[model samples]
Target: MKWKVVVMLGAALTLFGCSKPDAEPTESELSNHQSQQVVIVHGLGRSAWSMQTMSDLISKQGYQVCVVDYPTLRQSIDNTLGESASAISNCLSQFEEADFVHTNQSKTHFVGHSLGGLVIRSYLANHPDFVSSKEMGEVVFLGTPNHGSDVADYFVNNGLLSLLGETATSLTTDPNSFPNSLPQPNYEFGVIAGTQSYPVFSGMFDNSNDGLVSVESTKLEGMKDFVEVDIKHDKLRRDPYVTRLILSFISTGTFDAS
Candidate 1:
């Protein structure tokens, strides 16, 4: 099997594989392989479709993949966390219930993009035990607002933008908002930020940003590793470099960083 590598160069992210794939293994051949599952949650205003590409590539690596969907545009993170947790649980439960794969050391990884990252954080905060029970692995946040999004505050202040509803307003990095209330990640995790910004919302950020989320905003207190890619916020999930970086981290527990 070939293991991929994620490397950080000046101002950009690059991905290169370290080895070549050998012959494909049969079911019997993989029977002893450590089973793993990856759960992908899409960001605000998006659906599972947005994460399908990442899911497919992960599945090609022989891990089971689950793409979770929710009403991110209408429901607040508070309301969506439980549902996302349930969906992820259901996905992991299939392997256990069917006995198709060994559960003794089964591992589960979580991936979220943008607001989807916050949803995962909220889920963990609310259901701390799920980590140990599921043999939890590392988490990867792509362009997520760990602190909060200034664009969110910008939109909330504009009366017309409020029509987008709670989902839109809830992301503000207000002193007393949901994002600020959450605890730092207890499990291994890394955040990938986009150095490029969308020209339209670029003015909303006080510092370097990925259109909606500032690089500073994507940072959490105890992140295992951090790196910036030239990709944009919404496109981070699908960007080849970003996706390969995700694969590298989930498999190795680390990605190259400056």
Candidate 2:
């Protein structure tokens, strides 16, 4: 009788231990459960404020957003890369603050527009320490000139290209420089292209372009997904459709144009 009672007690204990539910997630875990930091870099001649709308939208979905501001026209690619890296470090520091304040330590995601995309690519390629293959979640490019821009050539002859310094030539005439700066598609990345052309610059492109870069040129080698928006080049950054596509890509590794 004593032995049977002991066996029954042991069996009851085992069932209780197995049936106990997991504790509820802490405040920090709840906040960072589906949370991630998004760093937005603007294109040439554009300030960090250019990405404000996108940042706000993402923030509404429980993400911390940082829009990096740098002197786009005053420096070469090397100098710009240095400044951009510093900005990225600063954004990470802000995450540390969030950890201290809210007790959440989440990873970061990078999203760049036009020349800014190139800057992120160059920085990631050159400075592997800042972002490791495992640490990086996703990278999104908006109207990035992966294959250089013909408009840059026109701007160079017209003297407007001086504002962009070495960046203009690096993307246009000096193909070897900027092309080599980017890392191969070893990680997950998405590219968004603009198909609508502004009337004034329609004659500039060979065929279909956003007045600056061609749709074909935006098709990079390592990109996991590619999308085309009917909006013009300048307006592509602000399109709601583009924003939805970007959000979809970030959440899932794939994006559909429709």
Residue-pair clashes per prediction, in order, are: 0, 0
Report the Cα RMSD per candidate: 9.4, 22.0
Question: Candidate 2 versus the native: TM-score?
Answer: 0.79
lDDT of 1 by residue, 52-147 (tens): 777876776667677888775456555666677787667767755654656565778889898778888878777778766757878998888888
Model 2 C-alpha lDDT per residue in residues 1-258, reported as the tens digit of each score: 556434533332221100122234456544763357788888876778777777766666666788988875657877877888798779877865775333234467788888778877876776676566344668898888777776665555555556547754566634575854566755679998888875545666887887677787777887889887777666666666677677668767676424
Native-referenced Cα lDDT, model 1: 0.71
Over 4 Å off in model 2, which ranges? 1-34, 100-105, 177-180, 256-258
Candidate lDDT values, in order: 0.71, 0.68
TM-score per candidate: 0.83, 0.79
Off by over 4 Å in 1: 1-34
lDDT against true structure, model 2: 0.68
Best candidate, TM-score: 1
